[model samples]
Target: MELITSNTHQNQIIEEDHVIKKANGNFIEANTLKVTLEHLKNECIIPVFSKDNESTISHYEFVLKTKEIVQDLFPEFSVSEPDIRTSHIIKGRIPSAIGKPAKELKEHEKTLYYERCAFVMEIPEVVENVNGNKLALTIGGVRAYNQENLFSKKSPEKFKVFIGFKNMVCTNLCISTDGLADQIRVNSLNQLSEAVEKLLGQYDRNKHLGMMEKMSRHEFTQSQFAHFIGKLRMYQFMDKTEQKQCFPISINDSQINTVVKNYYHDPNFSCSGDGSINMWRLYNLFTEANKSSYIDNNFERNVNAYDLTNNLVYSLQNQSSNWFLHN
Candidate 1:
């Protein structure tokens, strides 16, 4: 489906503030530090393959190239400054004619490069309001040292790209399998660009949004909510044979605890005074808790949240025998 035309003048007014708010809220308690695009390009060191002179694609290059592609495809969309995360730092000291031990090298002589990076950019103009919460189109990718073999010849580098919605209120990503390219192996920038373009071109935005809208129509009573929590907690300990019969959930016990806490305490998504919660709010609770995940695991878990919640909503509407929903 074609993107809905946005109000340019009004979007410009709130764009900066919106970017700042999202940057501040995202990545709390996570294994990453936020950085600006300029900082990433100018301050970070580019890494080279250990066995060859060839350099791997830098994080800045990946993000910049993707941004260029997005701008070309959707010129009217206002892209936010990148929300960046870098970890697993590799440090070194410059070689000197007078050989010295590593401990003797001055701090100023030390150079560093991050071994992993993940980032997301939001298209604020491409937004949808579901039950009073705003979700904007977001695109991002991840690069990790573990995904590559630096000692080998110039092999296909690994990357992951995802297109989804970022909850404007909490900066929680909402993704599904349709929106994620989990294993993108490419040899060059051109190949990477093509991969990203194909993913965006094929995504069904209308169908995804329609599913989210349907979630608002399904509610969980206090009793049902309690049962769901108990069943989910038990599912983690269930045997593989038993788990295969039920809808899959990727979140861990800590995240489930967060969901139960938010069901009663979240300012915007909490259950109503009647002690009932809708699927949409419950879905957000799961996504919200996912912010604590490591950068490598975050997007995958976000997609799982959408899949799990979507199935729950289906069970609620069709009276299916989902283990979490049925008695």
Candidate 2:
């Protein structure tokens, strides 16, 4: 039987005060706006994914669809070709079938496979010059063998789209929630352009720049940095009310300390003139650990890393009002 796919093409405008329109017919928005990645997910992404459908879209197919949607909506931005990254979670030391292609290995022989495929498109040069930074949009899908749901017979994949900013001088990747773009799962055939424009229109470039500047200016002393680390560690087990949980597994203080030390030791992080540490550096520290810290099949590790990163960002945003209020 042949598979059938639906075409979802639609457009609508959203009135946003923070959106800035350039002379060249391009617009830029800030990440600090009320409309955030989470809000976008709840508003558009979740509904699309929840639609009733007989067939499910594969990760590869979703990437292609997203790429097409993006290119069609914004013709000016330079979009990158789609790329797939696969990691072999289970491999045997001895070769079972030497003649067969490595890519054709069976699931039982391989045991588990992990994949994170993405398409990165560059933001226009004009926008970059205006913002004083280089930026890119990443639309990607992730699927690990253990994360798959076969028994439930549901879609066994996930999708996301976000923006990344690179510092012009320091060259550090400041990964923030792609507030300008929607980070959502490819669940159904739905209108993409309207959802994208609505989110983009909410971006206030000036507000985002101001927030970034604030993060850069605030410097943490040695004692302050240590306190930050303590807060980060505590946040892992505590709830929003600062109530601690009794987990089955013991909390590893040494591992947390090692992760914290690794961030400051890294030379790429931004530092104040007085040699104090910046929030951007601290933020990257969590992001890097989240992405590369775990080699084993501990899915919970990634979840915890994600949560930690969110907590860190929230703390930085309201450092003056109430630091660690969410913990």
| TM-score to true structure, per model | 0.87, 0.53
- Give one digit per residue, the lDDT tens place, for model 1 in 1-327: 111111221211223323333346773357777777887787677876777768888898899998888888899877888888887778776766136777788866777778878889989899887556678998998888777888877788888998888878778887878999988998888899999999999888888888887777777777888888999999999999999988887899998999999888876677877677777778888998888787777888888989988888777766667778666
How far off is residue 150 in model 1, in Å? Answer: 2.4
Best by the TM-score measure: 1
Model 2 misplacement above 4 A = 1-55, 88-119, 124-148, 153-158, 166-187, 190-206, 237-259, 270-275, 293-327
- lDDT (CA) for every model shown? 0.79, 0.40
Candidate 1 lDDT trough over 10 residues, lowest sum: 1-10
Question: What does each candidate score in C-alpha RMSD?
Answer: 7.2, 15.7
Clashes of each: 0, 4
